[model samples]
Target: MYRAPRGTSDILPREQAYWRYIEQKVVNACQLYGYERIDAPAFEDTKLFSRSVGEDTDIVEKQMYTFEDRGGNKITLRPEGTAPVCRAYLEHGLHNLPQPVKLYYIASIFRYERPQAGRYRQHYQFGFEAIGDDDPALDAEVIDMAWQFFQSLNLRHLSLQLNSIGCKKCRPGYLAILKDYYASHTRDLCSDCKTRLKRNPLRLLDCKKPQCQQIANSAPRSIDYLCPQCDEHFNRVKRYLELLDLPFAVNHRLVRGLDYYTRTVFEIQPEVEGAQTTLGGGGRYDDLIEELGGKPTPALGFAAGIERIILNLKKQNVPIPPLPRPQVFIAHIGDKARDEAIKLAAALRKNGIGVIEAIGNKSLKAQLRQANTLGAHHTVIIGEQEVKTGTVILRDMTTAQQRTIPIVQLQEELR
Candidate 1:
């Protein structure tokens, strides 16, 4: 049998309630944070990411699914949400009206990376972005939205990991220090790190290799070298979080995998592991709008993978929507009763009562057996005896008791 492509997953009925719950929480949180919902395409021009997400980033460099379209224009399935949001911001000229256009999208983003636990090639993301302002308060607000989202889900053991990847002013100075530090230890670096040292030293700190991680500990911190303005912004963001009683940690090594992020970067992960660990993560991208050919807009947002969040809910063994009860299973004995049973079922349905029926049954006993297997609470049985008398037999499947009721009063009697 044909099956779904590798690294992709189908969300089936049994596990779908968790997705509904997560979507609800995210939508509700977005509403509370004053972020209007917006939708962009699943794919766009390949240059969108190359410009916004960065040429050196893993998503742009290797993971993107790009191809030439019919007219020979290069297009790509969006590997992330920010670039598309920025594209929309410019295409629709939203920057014309608002100071900061706050938007959010629940989208399925694509990638070509090796799939791992809680990760997929075609994964869903809950993303948000605020453009047009460089205010630190907005940074704190976006972070709070993510934090409160976890809290709303009753998710425990989550750590608020925050950092500031400085802007152009101070970033160069930090890069200088980082390059000098890494250049001295070139012989100890991995091939990838050695190459990154020249292109983007910040990426070297983002490597997951343990050998690379060790070398990165000695690299420069953006927090230390932030320009006066960026430093003030980062500090104010901290002050806001503190004032709101939201706890966060400074992970200097958390150089978010994207180059667009500036001044604020963060991730929300379950402090507990063994299953429900990284629920979702996102950070600020202050330069993305400008990179996408719009005004130099400051933005901060995050996206969570639906699969991982649902898996985390499963690990906690959360209860979901209960099975619905079928109020009546209509059973008919002869062809005449079967005709009338159809009318009865429709009438019952019109009254908002749940009804299940198997028509033209061979025997009353057989029909009743089917009703029991279906877990029907009440069985509406129309045999020759009841049909000829303008009455019906209502059997309480739960109590095994039977009573005759007039056809017109069947609904009222059941109620």
Candidate 2:
């Protein structure tokens, strides 16, 4: 039998309630922060990510699903959300309308990576972006919004890891220092870190290999070398976060694995036993807009993996609101009863009553069983006698008590 491809899984009906709960909570939080929703194309010109996400990053270099279309254009399914949103901002001239365009999106992102427990080839992301502003307060606000979203879900033991990767001015100097430091320990570095040392030295800091991770932990920190402006910006962002009562730790080794990120970088991870998984992360990509051919615009954003959040919720045994139960089930026993049941079901639905029908089930016992399985509040029974008398029996499934009412009064009675 054919099956879903590797790194992907079907989101069956049984699991949809959890998704809806997360989406609704995210939407409500975005609204609370004055962030309007925006959606960009699922795929875009391959150059969009190559330029914005950075050429050396794993997402652009390996993970992106790139292909040539019928038009001979290099297109790629979006590996991440922020780049496409920024492309939309530049394409639509959002820069002219406002100083900072605040937007949020719950979108599907594609990445060709190993399908692990909370990771997938096709995943959903809840992302928020604020473009055209350089205020440190914007950085704090974006982090605050992410925190509030998790708080809304009642996710426990979430800790924020914060860092500063500096900007163009101070970063080059830091890279020089980092390269020199890594040069002395070249023999101990992983193969990837060796290449990173020559290409993008900062990436070495985020390497997951145990040896590289150990070296990174002792490496020189970017915060200590931040330019005056970057230092002040980082300090203000922390001060704002404290003012908002959001706690975070300065993780010197937390260099986000993106080329465009400058200054503030952070990740949110739950303190779980055995391999702490990051729920989400993002940073200030102040130069991304300009790199993508738009005028210079300082932007900051964050994205959370919906799948990871759901897994954490399940792990914590957090309660998710149950799906709505059908209020009325229409069961018919004869041809005339089936016809009458269809009409009654329509009328009840039009009047804002939730109705489920089992007109195909000829046996009343089977029909009642189906209603019980659905946890319906009430079951409407129509038979030859009821059809002839223009009446129907409404059974309260919970109490197992039923009563006959005139067909004309059924709608009002259900309400």
Candidate 3:
């Protein structure tokens, strides 16, 4: 039998409630922060990510699903959200409208990676992007927003890891220092780190291989070599986070894997044991817009993996709000009653009553069973007699008590 491709899973009906809950919570948080919703195409010109995400990063180099289209354009399913949002910002002249365009999106992101417990090839991301601002407060606000999102879900033991990877002014010096430091230990570095050192030395700091990680932990930190301006920006971001009463730890080794990031980078990680898993993260990609052919604009944003959020929620056993049940179920016994049932359901719906119709079931017992399964507040029973009398029996599923009512008053009775 054919199955869903690897690293992808179906979001069945039973699991939809959780997904909806996350979407609603994230959207509410975005609205609370005065962010408008914006959506971009599912795929874009392959060069969009190649330049914005960085040519040397794993996302653009390997993970992106790039292919030629019928018109011979190099297209790629978005590997991440921020780039596309930035592309839209530049394309639609959002920069012309406002200094900083605050936007949020709950979008599907694709990455061809090994499937793990909560990691998938195709996952949904709740992302927030604020473009055209360089205020350190924006950095803290974005961090606070991400913290508030996880807290809104009632997640526990979350820790914020913050760092500064400097900017163009001071980063080149840091890279030289990092290269020199890694040069002596080249024999011990992983093959990827070796190549990373030659091309993008900062990437060596984010290598996941155990040997590379060991070397990376002892390697020179970017924060130590930050330019005077970058140092002040980093300090202000931390101060703002503290002013907001958001606790964060300084992780010198926390260089975000994106090329667009500058000055401040961070991740919100769950404090669980075993392998560390980041719930979500993003940093100040101040140069991304300019790199993608737009005028120079400073922007910051964060994105959380919805699948990982759901996993953590389940792991913590946090109570998820149950899906709403039908207020009334319409069960019919005969052809005439089924017809009446349909009409009654439609009328009740028009009047703002939630109704479920089980007209296909011929037996009353079966219809009531389906009503009970649906957790309907009331089951409206119609038979040949009731149809002829222009009435329905409204059964309260919760109490298993029912009473006959005139069809004309059905709306009021159910309400």
TM-score of each: 0.89, 0.97, 0.95
At residue 378, candidate 3 shows an lDDT of 86
259-375 in candidate 1: lDDT tens per residue? 787788888887775543566777777777777777777777788877887776677776655446677999998888898899999988988998988855458788888889888
lDDT of each: 0.84, 0.91, 0.89
- Is candidate 1 or 2 superior in TM-score? 2
Model 3 accuracy (lDDT, Cα): 0.89
Across 285-402, the per-residue lDDT of candidate 3 in tens digits comes to 8888999889999999999899998888888998899888777888988888888988888888888888889956558888888888888888888999998888888888888888
- Candidate 1 lDDT score at position 328: 90
Worst 10 residues of 2 by lDDT: 271-280
lDDT of 1 at 157: 75
Candidate 2: segments with Cα more than 4 A from true spot:
208-211, 274-276
Candidate 1 deviant stretches above 4 angstroms: 209-211, 273-277, 323-328, 351-354, 359-379, 392-403, 413-415
Instruction: Rank all candidate structures by their TM-score, best first, as comma-separated numbers.
Output: 2, 3, 1
Clashes of each: 1, 0, 0
